[model samples]
Target: MSATIVRRSAIMTAAVAASALFLASCSSGGSSDPSDSATGSDSASAPTGVTLVMWHQSADADPQLNLYKAYEAASGNTIELVDLPADTYTTAVQTKWATGDRPDILEYVPTPQDMRQLNMSENMLDLSDLAFVGNRVNDAGELDGAVYGAVLGPLSSFGMFYNKDVLDAAGVDVPTSYGDLMTSCDAVTASGADMVNIGGGSEFPVNMFAGFAYMADYNEGDQWGQGVADGSIKVNDPEGPIVASLTTMKDLVDAGCVNSDAATATFQDSIAAVYDGSSALTILPSDFISLFYEAGGGDTATVDETIGFGPISAEKGIGSYSASPIGSYFVPSTGDATKEAAAKDFIDWITTEGYQDYVDEAQAVPTLTNATTPDLGGLYASLADVLMDPSTTPAFNQSVPGFGSFGQVSVSVLVGQASPQEAADTWQAYVDQAIEAQQ
Candidate 1:
């Protein structure tokens, strides 16, 4: 953020006048400063007059839309965007793909299990050789060690959100651990605010609570994830964290720390409760920081002083890490070499010289070592700090082989249809089925 320089990486590009595309080849160490210019044959250049058809979720707006325009202006290319509803984007992509419909590029989830619907190895380009892949990302857009999607944005961190005034008025410090959390519930109730809010009606938030506790207990959950991936770590284990987490949920409810309408409340309702000072906290991803402030109808400048986000765990200040929040660009195989190379050029441009432009515009945390990080104040700054957590574990879905939801079962616990142990058993059944299908 301190320096302003145009980014120009060494991407060797030759104009294909007839096809109206540039075949750009990039070296790993190309300069990101565009002002430095393309100096060598190994350097890459922005494509000229290439028109790319791209698809993005409808929820994607603002700086995202502007970022694409910036790329078109800087690279002399036209990107025709197709917006699909976020809830149905993946299903629509798959349905269309079944009929041989494919876009030149797509904004999609980068995980292997979630993205497998597209048949990536056979249909998508392997982006391992892209200049930024070696450093800027770990598993954001990777599958089997190769990068498929270009993740040129901030990684989403998982944790709890609290109203600063709510907690302070209750005369309680931020709870360090779940055990620490329990002790403060009485004071929070005395202050006349619900201790926490949940949207079990949506199912995801209920599972999020369980997952938060699981991640804290096993930081860097690679070994446990591997167990789940291979079907050895059964979700039904009587002593598993799933059972414990649900038991904790019941205890909190019995203690009057949670809202009466928890099972019927939606995620939006929970955020509204915290914003209206009806509740003290809600467990959710940091990406939703804007919604809480928006829900309150308060000025944006007061977000930092009014709201705070932190890790919710068995241990204090250590939380879960989920890469799913980091949406990435995936280029499908078009069988046109010229257009294909142009796609790479576009990806190269955004993560390099054009990245700072977006960081300034979107106020995003820079994912790359080379890119300067601006002061991301408010809850965002706290979320950014979570990325630096050395012992953070991957989100539960990280190792799962396909689209599976722990929430699908955990919701039963909230409704009292199943006990914690029973819910775990049902989830384990689903996990076993998914792992077998993989083989």
Candidate 2:
């Protein structure tokens, strides 16, 4: 579902490319100028058939699309949805922004890393003081204590999802840290299975390799970005999370603690490796439960029975909430006073008055205090447990601007091409570069 989770563009060229794509897409959808700058009130006017341009990817669920229709019917406001192509959505958005074009409302990944690209602090309407803020299950879109994105449904957190039966058979308690994980490799290998399956080939989950360690910090890494930004923290610190985590990865490789085909393994392979009992565990997001569903013939019963979820950390069981903001919506600082107010009203109404209906429409596990969690399954329950954990905090990628690149070199740790220190050094270079660019 993710891919733009990072990608930079050739500013001028992408802007040119975006012009044709934007026009073509807008012609078929509803056309609106994103550069509207008639600033006025921050409050919504009574419904008068105002059309709000909403930019979303094709992956926007039918429930959400239908919800928009329901919203229009109730409020008499027209939501002109623009379905941008998922692959180029971020770059296209960036390009549109480069040319001073923006949507009234936009759906995005809602990560500090991603938000940094959008300059959310300067560009997005703050949702911190909204009435429903207290009801939110997690702070998915908060940066520097300011909330900017509202995640209405769906949740994800990353960790080492293990096969309970396999780990139990291996006589391994859920290891508290990567070092603790290594102490059980002998027991795990003796049980005739690999220790963990790093899905290196997909390259998507690689970030979690080192991120788990950073996220498990004392403050759950909420201040990680601030540290890096203010030059108080260094990515390449020899004793830091990056080197320590990556070194453990290399040690796992040497200790025969990973799958034989770990280098080429995909997410599917990692799922099967653990679920089919070929490996004890895999490092992935809570959504691995969804993939395991496919492996088990779409059976939630099988998924719940065989799989187990636990938070991963460097030296403790502490974890971070890493949910993808699927139903999250961001209102741009579009400067059209009327549209801005309507956008705020939409957020307020959906999260308050229309919330129950919204939850029912998505069949989502309740992430609000007012709603009750439905009977999705044991797997869904586990996913929600980690997502709503009181101790967990937003991940580094969720707090640090441009922090996505910090973990970009983690796959090299998996393939043994870079030593832990080397990986950390590379990350430090990226951090320095990002800080310079931001400054």
Top of the candidates by TM-score: 1
Clashing pairs in 2: none
Over 4 Å off in model 2, which ranges? Answer: 1-104, 111-113, 126-130, 133-147, 153-155, 168-171, 187-192, 260-264, 333-346, 357-368, 375-377, 387-390
Model 2 Cα displacement at 98 (Å)?
A: 4.4
- Encode model 1's per-residue lDDT on 140-162: one tens digit a residue: 67666567888766555678888
lDDT of 2: 0.68
- Give the per-residue lDDT of model 2 (tens digit) for 234-315: 8788977667777777888888988878777777788888889888888776645556776888687877788877777877
lDDT: worst 10-residue window of model 2: 3-12
Clashes of each: 13, 0
Alpha-carbon deviation at 276 in model 1, angstroms: 1.8
TM-score per model over all chains: 0.82, 0.73
* Count: clashes, candidate 1: 13
